[model samples]
Target: MPELSGPRSGSEVPLELLRTPPPKERADAARNRAAVLEAAARLFAEHGVEAVSLDAVAAAAGVGKGTLFRRFGDKAGLAVALLDNRESVLQEAILYGPAPLGPDAAPTERLTAFTDAYLDFLLPHLALVRVSETASPGARYRIGAYRFWHRHVAILLASAPDPDVAAHTFLAALAAEHVAAVLPELGEQRLRAGLHQLGAALA
Candidate 1:
């Protein structure tokens, strides 16, 4: 018999419950997830993120409401899912790809490259990025991506007297709301220059 962790633990629960799903179920689940994502993307693209609902997504995907909710807990979850592919690609480049983004360059160069890459990514998906950031109070800082960025920045700032605080300040300057507010006045060129300058100062 398997050991139990608490009085409420179920020692009689079937072992199959703890095991991976059969291949067929796994394939079906994958297909359903893809279909839901595709449907949500198309709906959001045509109608805008604010205008579309999870119910609408479920109907569009031909999946049940329960399935949609189970797959993505809420609209914010859906937004994160939509951004995941692009985010993953950027993260991969940062961690493993060449030049200033990867291990091939100095820490300062990598930091500059990261800021440039992030700004480029943010500009194109301004609406989506904003939605993801503002999902709830302090939501942006709570996300996995935010943590990853913070850690990366902190590592690059290792020589700083207070790396954590400096990292937070650096990232705050690039917050979606802050950028959106200043972008029109500063223009992309000025904003990029300002970010590079900030990075240089931090370094």
Candidate 2:
């Protein structure tokens, strides 16, 4: 549950590790955005993400349906917006915080830390992430967040026979859809342990 308070002094980070903030909003627009996300969060929690609709979110937020669609595009986009803050925290940790989740750890340790930290965020947000990732064919791979994770894992697996392929394989197991499908059977402890073993083998 630990997170980076701020970037470490003198630490340089890759461009991919940087997340671009969304365009600034006007005061009224910002209020609308906040209301939309807040309403969506409540509805998703109350009824599950899959059961909620953009129309419902707009109604709950007191925004026009057209406004919601224009701002977020779709339910998947809304889900992505909702996770932005939590994802940024993890991103900052990987980009500049302390070992083993940050800069300076040995690859094996960093890899393990990454899985553990990722799961910490992911498990609680599984349904939201599953919607964002599985919204379309190859939607997960298309995400900038996925590219950042894949790059980190691929670099850590550089000594492996096929780092690129292995990284994809490694992340495949961690995908929200895949993890959600198996979690009920394997449970969190076994899943974490198995991922640790996989990380060791890949590293």
Candidate 3:
């Protein structure tokens, strides 16, 4: 179990774990990586994430399939690489920035703020986010970044009965696949509004 404690708890996973710096790479390796990400992004945007493949990305990047596989492992890993910077920024805000997302607000308010910010993040990148999340069965649960989000929300819900379960339930409502399915019907505004009801029932 993740240590449920204050922000600076020694047992807590380090924020550095989430905001990892890119590994140093030789110029050729770095170029290939940049080229791969650029090509993948363009292809994903144009054809939709589900419609594209790692092979397509590799061909677009002019890198060999072997290189793409070695560098990113798969399409999911490539999506994750593309999202790293934005995820790091969001993590930084939640940990150190300001009220609501930061530690300064009341728990309910913070959770609501998280929902709002996260919806904004999820909307534009829905396709890619879904790809990263649904790469494999239970892939979302296994992601390191998912753990960070879970821990943060679980901490905020610390006063509840089974904050762990509450956190998981709340996050279930925001899963990329679920959101994608509901979005066209609910649309962004109603969708976000519905999600804002995190329910004092949990409290």
Candidate 4:
């Protein structure tokens, strides 16, 4: 029976005793958190990251502005959380999705799968994807995926005429997206074709 009024309402209550909830949450906290994240994602997607403020997120989520800051620390932290949420989906597809993309395929096949998987997964996320690419200490959302592709290609390159040369070449080729940003003419189909040719050459 926690009182709904001023500090004196629970003044007689012991600190630890009042801190404990019957079930740790009154149900509203969990709902509010979910609503907040969902609203953040939607708003961030609709409006660019910089355009969406904490107050807007709170209004969209139906929570107080204080709650948003408390949960996410700050705007950058909120952005990172959104990126993490997106990466989790991509991780599941690559690590546990269909054949070739997952672990069951042959090395060469997985290499191709890696290229295709990234193209498919990353294309839709291009909007939010660019945000993490800029230099930031905690901006590591893409590192795991990039490392996985590099590791897979490096393994396949090990048996090549010059493994070192092949691995570096493969790495350089896979970095086409960075170039794609500069070259607007390179569409998705051409990008995939280019990656396939590069993979074939490295393999």
lDDT of each: 0.77, 0.85, 0.81, 0.60
Regions of model 1 farther than 4 Å from truth: 1-25
The whole-model C-alpha lDDT of candidate 2 against the native structure comes to 0.85
How much is the lDDT of residue 165 in candidate 2? Answer: 82
Candidate 2 lDDT over 1-203, as tens digits, reads: 32223222122344343464665989999999999999999999999998998989999999999999999999999998998888888888887788989877788999999999999999999999998998999999877688777777877777888777888999999999999999999999999999999989987
Report the C-alpha lDDT of model 4 over 72-188, residue by residue, as the tens digit: 767655655565655555555545567676556675786787777666656665555555544364343344444434444555555677654565576655443464474367777
Cα-based lDDT at residue 181, candidate 3: 96
Cα RMSD for predicted model 4:
15.3
Residue 179 Cα positional deviation in candidate 2, in Å, after optimal superposition: 0.6
The model with the greatest lDDT is: 2
Clashes of each: 0, 0, 0, 0
lDDT of 3 at 21: 66
The positional error of residue 145 in candidate 4, measured at the CA in angstroms, is 4.8
Q: Which pairs of residues have clashing backbones in candidate 4?
A: none
TM-score against truth, every candidate: 0.83, 0.90, 0.88, 0.62
Residue 112 local lDDT, model 2: 94
Give the CA lDDT, 0 to 100, for residue 11 in model 1: 32
Highest TM-score, which number? Answer: 2
Q: Total clashes, candidate 1?
A: 0
Candidate 3, 21-132: lDDT as tens digits:
6668999999999999999989988989889988899999999999999988998999889988788778878877788777678888888888888887888998888988
